[model samples]
Target: QREFTQKKTFTSWINSILAKHTPPYVVSDLYTDIQQGHLLLDLLEVLSGQHLPREKGFNTFQCRSNIENALTFLKSRSLKLINIHVADIIEGKPSIVLGLIWTIIFHFHIEELARTLACTYNQPSLDCSSAVDSSPKASRSAKKSARIKERWKMSATKALLLWAKEQCSLHGSVNVTDFKSSWRSGLAFLAIIQTLRPGLVDLEKAKARSNKENLKEAFRIAELELNIPRLLEPEDVDIVNPDEKSIMTYVAQFLQYSKNLPESEEDLQEKVREAMGWLAAQEKKLAKLLVETENETYYQKCKEMMSFMETFNQEKTPFLPVLSSKRGEAELSEGQQQMREEWDKVVSQINEWKAKLDQMLPSPLDSIEAWLQEVERLQAEDLPDLQDPFKAMSVFREIIVIFKGLMDCFDSHLDTLQSFKNEDEKNMPLVLPEKLEEMKRRLFSNIRSTNPSTFLEYHYGLCSAIANEVKLKLNICDVKYGAKESVESLLENW
Candidate 1:
């Protein structure tokens, strides 16, 4: 069932990409069309913008060779293929072919969507230098930006997940954690449509409906209102396990539609400057908040966090439309990139502070599940790479202490759960104790496996190599024709 849907969805998606070529290519039959490997090579070339070598012969060996060449190209990009072989694709193995096409869609389409979300329609390239000042000083400043955009890259799976999560966060109680079961209730789709095109889906009505009903309506509205292709039926997604690939393909269309919103260069630049100013202001406010709350009490920190969240929503929510409108261009400028880096720092500090406060607070059995989830989230986050050893070590020690406290907190909660196990089942959740025990075992296993010494050693090595690389250039500044070169001119040229 899923294979059929993926084939249809992926075929349309492939033809969409191929349609942009000089002489457009279309895949009528996904399984057999690529058996000759010419179309496969064409598709790869179209996706990657890289010319690939292919066999022009009609022989089976030549066909297999072409397929192998495509496989090799995929491998060169560091894409790990599991149980996928050249013979499977050459033979037109249905499942294998579907998997191969899905991989291509995930890599070239879905993964690339995040970076392209900020660009206008038909504008894939993000080099909008003319949108800002093109003076030598501005150019030099642009070159020195923090490269903050690179940090936002994630796997295609994670990119879709983050987009869904961000969209669903605006709606009520629609938490999109993963691609599979998260959309089972169908509220996620509704939330996405409602947020993207306001008033498209009625949340109050959708809430009262059954899963299948909501799923059907969301798909209908998305297709009718947004012109998004109906890639999946209610029965397909409202299942015990919905197909992640199908949902991603369908959701990616929304991202495509989102980037096409009309805005003039003048308006876009004005919005960009406005967003830059807002982010700059936020950086200052968050920096001050971080310092003030550094040694504050748990209650004080909680108060600050709550107040910050309110202020954040009020101030930041207004800019979301413009930010989403020109997301790609926002990170391309010197001022925008610097502001984004500071904004990223602000977010990182908030997470760190939240983790600290969580450790200081106590949790009842009812809220322990939420607490555990938060702890797991915090633990799953990788430590940031700080060039300064002092900064890195300080952060490492603070996190370690919070984690240690969380372990103790978990133990204390576990003991409480165990005590209530013999009590009435109605008053307490029967599965809570077993669930906590399982979680505890996993948490402890992870903690035991983690060696802090290894991290510290790695950090030490990174610190030593911080300034190992340098880009040095010597330029001769010759003032000619009795005209003296200004200091600004020399600095800009330098």
Candidate 2:
């Protein structure tokens, strides 16, 4: 009893000292609501102390020989920030700006930090990212995020198969049995690539660092703001056993779409839209049944990750283009214009790839300039914190989400094909399972058990199919880009 009391008192003393010295941003608005400065600072100090260099340069951060002496002094029992002090030696920057620079170390690549810490200090076995969610409607947006557990329902994706590939193979030859796993697996593959992109881990870290209350409140606001009816997050409860026959029914229904492969971008998008509606309905029905059978634990912490994503997309706009712009136009030499133009060339190359997939193209060059302008504007504004790293990671994830998903790209081709599958049914070949008659009987039984009306909600379970289509579209686009390119040689030869 005495020991416990001593520990609590000591912890309080540390908290008070930290709150007195640290900035508010260090303590996320997402987690804390009480506004007790000392407790907040204590949290910041613990979090920051975890960031201290453990052993060598390569272990913790973007290390350097120059920072060695500084690191040694900083990480000593004294626990001072000698690193930030060293960086503050700049000729004309504000003191806050120097502090902001240090924050970037964690934000830009927090995943790397997590990995290192896990390896070095032997961090907890608990997983950081909740799970993967590859739901069809997930491609666009759903109040801000679809949980990872929700995504796990998707099948494994080995490779992306697009309309182009589909045309050369089974456009008219696949049967119901073959298409079930094919479509689900395909969608899973697409979701994984997009989900695993560099920004995702960073975004997860940002969300974790956030105050639960702030994040939950933000979610509540988002629901109110976005207007989702009955917005309480679900928690895990009872698990439902998916009847095998119902699985067969799902597979059989999927094969119907495989009979037709879309040719036009519009056609593909229509199919994607179908998938979106179907998946939403399907999940809704499942959720209702779960509410009846399972406990509330399933989605308790399920804050809208997508909301954080949406918020980040808004924040990261500036820093991306900062390197090339800050030199005033009048002060610009010929070199700066060349750099901007070169960046535009890169953007255009990417657009050309998008056009082939019939996907909407991003503003290529204009967005770059806009991004640059955003960075400069933010640099001019009054920053909220000198040491917060969450903002940086938030910005990183937002950029990836917009560029990889929201930006005009090849996803439309699949959307087009998905929209008009019924029309192409005549042209598409059906791949029936070996035991067609038996499969049909079993499938119907499962369908009955699953409540066929539920599948009806997935609006036909087409979004997952569309998500698959988009993945295939992107694969082909990437292949084309990787095949060739040498401007200087071509120009000289010409």
Candidate 3:
């Protein structure tokens, strides 16, 4: 038949390629051992793309005899070398075992030979052939093949676990003295295992395994042997701080890194929370120190009022006398001239007092007026709003600090005004009680209520905006993930 001729040609081509690539020692061994000739033939058939040979029918009896002979020869002559070579090949190559399994089923119409080979090396035999008919024998063979395939898969899983352990040992010895290096090497080993057996490395599978006390104890022993660290390294710690920008950056990086960690690592999450709390305490301490410093400065300035009053009295006394005695008719003209001179001196003294007040008080009223005008200009300009919550919060906090500073200054100004009022009442002939009372009321009102109202309004607006943004973000997450549970898991992990 045409199929037979094609197969013969294919086999010849494969033989040529194998003869060119195979080592001379292996070829010599194959030729010297006639009993192992079937092994070479099977390898050549697999390489020649002969998955299911239709011609030159081989029955189960013939296939079993050849397999037994091959097994006996390998056991007697080269068992150790054969084991090493097979392990190395399985580790380095893909689908070789599967191809051999398929070839066995193709020639024998039975799965036992492949199953026996898989058992020899404790590997799983993959079933790669379909039933040719629906006879009772075929049905029984299908059932056996299915069972063998399941066993093979389990064997492969165990093999992968053993390989992972072996790799861990080969990579490095884990101990407290070299925890970081050892741990990193162990992680690399796990990564390799994951690449090889992704389905077996899942947390769900691990949880299932934990149900068996023996397996759970095995895992604990492995963890102990690997010397996995209970605590993170210093360089891995991310602490939230008062520097908002830096804190944001640190948190983002921490969230990203945490995503790569196993979801069951609750202890690591707790450690992160503890670090953040410690950093927050530090920020609180700094805030308290700042408040104390501001208070001390305000009190010190208040105590300097006595010296300032003394200076004011000394400057005023040179121009204004405490009292003027009545003058007789003979001295009336001289008194009138003296009165004009006194008036000129009083005017000059008032001018000097006004200039001194300008320098000392530097009325915030003018600054406030300018600020209001600027606010109006900004409102008219309709500038774009800030998009980031952290940035907006920073601006809001700065505004609150500025407003508080202004309020404190207003309080100090009021204290100074009251001190001046008391000094004037005690030493000067003139006092403007109504004007001072009105100014005091206006300054106190601005300090206590007016500025606070502005602060509250701006703060509320910012909070509402941030809340809306958070809601929008939540909605987007819901849409993307499509389930509340998944969203919660994502956020919790994040």
Candidate 4:
């Protein structure tokens, strides 16, 4: 009972192992067949165990013996079984086949496996027979066994080589140096598997020579393909008006291409150097052009400012009343007091104008001029790094907006001044005449109550006094001219 239980347990264990290790796409029949082939299972267990830690009680020599015994036993099987099953060994569980081959190489140090592998799938074996040792039947059986062994070895080795080639190809595209290293290691491993060190050395030399030639061809192709002159065309560079960035992009691309080329190519290196020099010269030219453009822009702004000033000077007129103290006596009569109060109101308006003018000065235009002067100085000294053209343009644009606003203020001020001037001119002449007529009517009505001559003399004295007051107040015209002069002077200074 115990023996049967152990057998059942072992069967279950092998089944699970095969299921876990075999790819899912492999049919269940393949696993079952491999499981029933006890010799192959035993060999797989031993070979797989070799990769485990020593603590797992792995025996290297026992593993080698197991693999040899498995191959030998497989040789004794029918030719149909050997061909079908051994091919399935490679097709169904290729990783296991590779592991077993690597294990054989590691333990036995044989080279036949790697050699047979390279040509197995495509090449046919010679049917040469060795001299018989005994009866015809025995000799024929021995020859058949040898043929089967050779066939199984070739199939297994071919599977392993195919797997390695696939892996190496994957690594090659990602990193050529790593691919080369893997290739060398694979060659070394294959040499040990086939036990053919001299053959591997020759193969390695041939491969290295071929790789060098291919690398030279690839470099030559790259040199011809990266046409730097066509890439750095003038039309392409003109995408950004001042094309510094475009030129630099072309330079960067050229440098990147040059970095990949072999350093031994002196002609390519010389071309790269010349291209870099040309790009450097182009950069300098662009920088100079930028500076000249900025200078021209500033000059244009200055012209605009000067032209605006000329128009402003032509359009500017004094808006304030020119009041003379002599126009009104220090002791003002009632009507004269009203005139004086109005004059004070005009002065207040002039004060307001002065305040606004004060706020507008060191104006945006003046600020732009100061900024331009600094930029010009930097440019003249060849210190282009110190200038910011964008900032300068922004300031210039703001000054233009501010000048427009100031012109609007000037227009409003002129309108207000003209309205006030019209009011004074329309009302001033009637003020004195109306007051004198009222005084004449009052004096004539009281003539019967006093001496006629005395009353007439009093009326004349009053008339003279009124005339003097009117004369004094009329000097506001002079005050108007004085205020206008002040405004003109302020504008001139501005």
Off by over 4 Å in 1: 1-5, 18-29, 49-62, 72-83, 116-154, 265-320, 323-370, 373-380, 383-494
Better of 1 and 3 by lDDT: 1
Whole-model Cα lDDT of every candidate shown, in order: 0.63, 0.28, 0.33, 0.31
lDDT of 1 by residue, 1-494 (tens): 77776787788778777887758997889888889888888999988888899888969999999999999999898676889998888889998998888877777777678545322322322121211111121112212222223333333444455556656654434555566777888898997787677766777688799999999999899889987767778888887666778888888888777767665667766766787787677768867997898886555666676676557644654444544333454345665455455554655565556445545543454466455655654544545555555566667767767767666666676666556452343553333233345445434443433435425744674555453322122223333424355656755775
Candidate 3 colliding pairs, count: 1
The candidate, 2 or 3, that scores higher on lDDT is 3
Residues 1-494 of candidate 4 have per-residue lDDT tens digits of: 32222223233333333454433122234333432234354435443443221121224444344344465543343222223334444343643443433333322222233333334223321111111011121112111211223345433332333323321221111111111122222232222111111121222333455433433332233235453222222222222122222222222223333234342345434433443343344345434544554534333433433343333222211110111111224333344344434433432333333223223323242332233223222221211111343343444444445434433443333333233221133353212232223223222221112112222333444565566656765654345545768867854763
lDDT of 4: 0.31
- Candidate 3 has which clashing residue pairs, if any? 124-152
Among all windows of 10 consecutive residues in model 3, the one with the lowest summed lDDT is: 125-134
> Taking the tens digit of each residue's C-alpha lDDT, what string does model 3 give over 92-178?
222333233223322331122233333323322111011111112111221131123423432332222222222222111111111
- TM-scores of the models, in the given order? 0.54, 0.19, 0.21, 0.13
Against the true structure, whose TM-score is highest?
Answer: 1
Q: Local error of candidate 2 at 451, Å?
A: 40
**What local lDDT score does residue 302 receive in model 4, on the 0 to 100 scale?**
32
Provide the RMSD of all predictions against the true structure, rounded to 1 decimal: 16.3, 28.4, 38.5, 50.3
